[model samples]
Target: MTDRSDAHTATTPLAGRRVLVTGGTTGIGRAIAVLLASEGAKVFVCGRDAQHLDDALARIREVGEGDGITIDLAEEENVARLFEAATGYLGGLDIAVVNAARGAEGLTDMSEADLRYTIGSNFTAYLLSAQHAAKAMGAHGENATGQGDIVLIGSMSAYVLGKESTVYAGIKYGIQGFAIALRRELGKKGVRVSLVEPGLTGSDMVEGTSEEQAERIDKEEMLRAEDIAVGVHYLLTQPRRAVVQQVTISPRMQDEE
Candidate 1:
């Protein structure tokens, strides 16, 4: 066998790159994973649910090289383990997509446990995952076949807000800031960092949206998971000398105010 690592060297921008996508079982994460694989990336993905993991892997395999494991990124060790396992499967990762996140609505009505869970899932997981991804990317160096990239999936909610989006927005603002700082610190390593803040995207996160917002989605007024994936791919394909550090994607019909 020629091996999966050498598979994508032929044509497309993402050809032959090793990629890791968190929350790959559903939503924007799944969309990103499938797209990357189709572009010839050796992709490994993770989710908390076993069935979702299998399903996502099968879907990715339908179009490209893909593997999966069940993981809860809330735990720091699990984040590290994910990187380790992915490195083995993909022959070291060139891209890390931190798209796994949970939202907490109504900080006023939510319990302490709920607060912790959201923070862990949203903020802490992102930080730890980026830390581990950065380490893996740094290990490869600029000259390595797999160049480095960390793509953080943030929410436009960092600037826009809903009635109960306090917790969710808070977490996004923290991680978004973190990604920018990490990019600065890693400038010497040639690892690219990008932040994508999407608005009113359709996914499991939509389940938490207000009925008014859901109505818009039902009417095809919001961005689909795949739409966001396309944007991420566009960012990923940019020349090595360029990077789209941050961008916000939104549905045309939806009002941001």
Candidate 2:
């Protein structure tokens, strides 16, 4: 007879899982990294800011084991080194959160350099990191057993199509498409590709004081970065036989602008 303990597990556990979170030094990425680490995952993170990286690592170490580096994921060389460092630190990877991005400017206001950097950071980096992470997880290898999760942190901007977000919307629409197709492509191999679209959230990207942000959260006008982190954790803890393709989290009172 099968033991009752084995027959009825409430949820898949995250303990001892290996994870990488790019752009994890601040904001939503930082929250995700810290939350996962607190759950006992061995986390490796990267960010463009050295100070933020150090602070994030300190927070992670307080709860669980982790390491990190400072590097912009927009460059191919940096992305390569990031994975190498992650693998070396964690030994192997079971999950990756692709969340790094640059805020977009109006098309007419964007300079050539701004355009290039925004595209590279917001869109191209996601593709490149996904490529590396999939390969590392053996998604394409002969032994391609179902074995990994890739969560792309997209935005509700893809659907809202706000007036000031021409470039940002386009990139997010591209990510929405990429995530769905990638999931289908990798489904048979056991790698889950999911897109998480967050609504207005209080973070560095949003301009506000701590008190203002707190008020907005209280009013349900915005979400906390940690709220999205909880949503991500839900995605990662699903049963192996199941998959959550997408999650769109928005404040209860948020409306299209």
Best by TM-score: 2
Worst 10 residues of 1 by lDDT: 138-147
How close to the true structure is residue 77 of candidate 1, measured as C-alpha lDDT?
83
**Tens-digit lDDT string for candidate 1 (79-145):** 8888889999988778999988886778998999889988888888888888788778763344433
Clashes of each: 2, 1
lDDT of 2: 0.91
List the candidate 1 regions with Cα displacement exceeding 4 Å. Answer: 1-12, 139-146, 208-220
Question: Candidate 2 residues 178-197, lDDT tens each?
Answer: 99999988889889998999
What lDDT is reached at residue 149 by model 1?
84
- Could you tell me every candidate's TM-score relative to the true structure? 0.88, 0.94
